[model samples]
Target: MTTERRVLVYGANGYTGKIVSESLANRGIPHYFAGRNREKLEAALSIVAERFGSPVDAEIAVASNNPDELRPLFAKVDVVINVAGPFMQMAWPVVETALECGCHYTDTTGEQDWSRAIAEQYGQAFADKGLLLAPATSYMWSAGALAAEIVLENKGVDSLDIIYQIDRGLPSEASTKSFLRMVCNDQLYLDLNEYAAWDWDTLVDVHVPYRGASIRAFPWGGACEPIWYKDDPRVLNCKVLTAMGEHLIDGVKMAIDKFHEEALSLSQEEREAWTNTVGDTMHQGEPPKDNVTAQRSCIIVGGQGQTTTVQYVMNLSAPYTWTGEVSAEAAKQLLAGKLLKPGFQSVATAFNHRELLQTFHELGFTSAPPAPGTL
Candidate 1:
């Protein structure tokens, strides 16, 4: 790795991509901002120039998944923070190119199946390459969950519940479309469908005193957390409750059901194509409605021996924003001679929580109880 931290942000023209660029600029880090859009990249460069006075020593490149363009991107920087996703369809090629060029790879991928795919298909190769590969270090899966791990070790926490709620901000239609495309990929939907197929009810009433009298919460996509809670049977269960309004959830459910009724007869390939077209076409706008103001963040685990029950919120709504930032930071760590050992990694896995939390805290997030947990 180069001694100086120079990064190529692969999805720099996205909604969250702008935020990543801002964070990197504010850090005084030299970055090569790139994306598939030449016009969009130019526009972002204008904004950056207006703020930071023309990058101080930065260059901009336009790139896509194509090797002719992507290969050059890899050679230009010590790392690539892939902010482009729903990563299930996109991970392998970008990761493959990065690995081939001997560059570190970091992304904000959260789909569990994708993780399984990586482990089964490429884990051994990544370890042998002695390259740092990290994934899922954002709002949904990494940071918040990592914090829960920290709080769990604090003693006296009988039952633990992490309630994640997104109250206001609407996701960009592009993100929504990508998410749908990922869902359309059959393997992505299989496990969730099978679990929901049983119509099994596996949640309980939680009274998070800090949030309110009580809120209905459930396990987050059936993720297993007992590994961290295994020592104490008293711990009961640790669940991530995606607590949003019932009306909203029910309304979305109806729309999904109607779509399914219309789509039940297509072959697998046809279904994929239709899903991509329809998803992209339907969600093509900023969808500009009321307040873009949104609340997004992971809640910490709270219970008896874990005496503190709480709720937290983050400003992030786009997955790429988190991925690009953390990945850039991880790359910088390598450049600074602070590189963590290679082989599969997450942003949190490569660094301590204190540094991560401190960086995020500066980004407008506030931890519950105000004191902030240790990294």
Candidate 2:
């Protein structure tokens, strides 16, 4: 990518946004910060300068929901790395503004409904403009999707079972709010190449090698993989399952069940208010700790067909840190004209899967053996 290309980190003041900004700075990518708070944006820039020993390009106070405030800056930028969360509520306007300004778009969203909506509603628009709309390029989903792509490379591998297990780390307030908003309804997955609903109350016992046995996992939001693979002609079935940790799985499941149960009687507005209330109680405005030393997570994707079976694994630590690096790398690749096609995409579909895996490998994100079809 050209060093002269401009990138804008929207929501630059948020917990994850600062990490993304740091990644961009480390890569020497030219970028600026934009957010609704002038003080927070300035503070973010100061943090970057203090950490890197050099000041960032600039910081602009712009309201994300205000198209008037966004249009000018977006029109000037080559790419927009949106770190804003609870994307279902805050992402559309930015996505619209990016397409209007002809800038590529990507975000750290794990909301399945949001991804499906973006693809169904705006996918064609982005393609028409030759721009991209890659959502959920974060660890929760994209990392596992990468593993699925690796397994798919093996011929005759049709169905996929993906799992995400996080053994440590606490949630940020924004992330907690996003989770509360999403778990209030059933999540959908691709079943035999068709949409299938996942009842929020059930859990699946699946094998996780790290655990050396089966562990209970939920189809948390069904993730973005099924959506990414829904239209691909590859073999049929896909299901995604995840768990915070064995210790917390039951509690997490109970909370989800409670939300879904209570939401049945509540109006839409009331459900939202209830979600905010519970989310605030759970997180209490705490910034998540980057405890890589204690962080133990696994993204396991396995594919089974009549005559073939394949599995790919990714052991992770501090996934939020990985999210930051992945966002910056994706923006760089897009600016370098490395995308497979425009419009709604997952990481594997949007860019070369192996190339991305290699990038992560070099950065210490992957410790597994080479994928079945790779050299």
Candidate 3:
């Protein structure tokens, strides 16, 4: 609520975090860069400065989720864009501190369970405090949700089938870890406006409009669009399915089966711990940089009603860059007091969807033909 609207980018040293930092820097927004590693944060600061050709007039803070350590830092910022991942494992302390310090919180999380948890456990608290808790504001989930919302604007479109297909790019270390942890169990989707378990074993065959071919995809730990629209009177059924290459999907299925077999006897809590340990060994290195073509993605959202069925196809490149752009922009919106509501919200709900989509177009993420309904 301060006039200056100070900002903080938590996890500002990680892969996607650095991208978020870069976006913020590109906007010429002065903010603090914070993470557990001061050395990495310092390195990220240098990168941002070098890229922008201007010294970012910002301080760097070293802190973890420990409230005593985080409170002072959180107090100094009006908004926190948390890019740290595997949110189910590491998000609580940061969330608690953000709430305690009266800061608006947003993160790049596609984990449906965690988003639902935020809504169920702390949605009212955030609303009561008149603070915003907008999770899953990144490319994975939010991008599709925004497209779904756009289609929903057409009258009588209620049921949404959201599918995300990334044609390229290697998953970052953090993303690989999160995916492994998420795919360890079944996910939830909306049926008759109620949450129902989606079997981890099932892979749905999704037709990619751009590719003009059907590919195997699954609700990779479920999509949060259903959760986001759970209370909306407009939606009755929602399911989200996603896939990379067919080979990658096959590998993921194999990993899921393997994990289930190995962790069959372990408690859910124990499985959570197990996934973390297993994820650490899977991918550990820097992701490819400035590879927009390799990071291309497509979103297919079809809305079905009693008699009408309309599908929208959007193609975009550079998923990670889009994440950074959107997250940084969301932080600015929060700082400017531009929010839809206080409680747990998606990017579409938190901002004007038309404006948001226009931003997407302005970012050069949107492409032509098939347009909206031609497909």
Clash totals in order: 10, 0, 0
Tell me the whole-model lDDT of each prediction, alpha carbons only: 0.55, 0.81, 0.81
Weakest 10 consecutive residues of candidate 2 by summed lDDT:
366-375
lDDT of 3 by residue, 220-318 (tens): 878789889997899999998888766477767877888988986899888887777776776657765544666778888999988788888878678
Residue 272 shift from truth in candidate 2, angstroms: 2.2
Residue pairs with clashing backbones, model 2: none
lDDT, candidate 3, equals 0.81
Model 1 Cα lDDT, one tens digit per residue, 187-208: 2112211222112233455654
TM-scores of all predicted structures: 0.73, 0.94, 0.94
How many clashes does the backbone of model 2 have? 0
Off by over 4 Å in 1: 1-5, 48-58, 152-161, 181-209, 213-239, 244-251, 263-268, 281-284, 287-298, 302-327, 339-341, 368-375
The local distance difference test score of model 1 is: 0.55
> What value does the lDDT take at residue 281 in candidate 2?
75
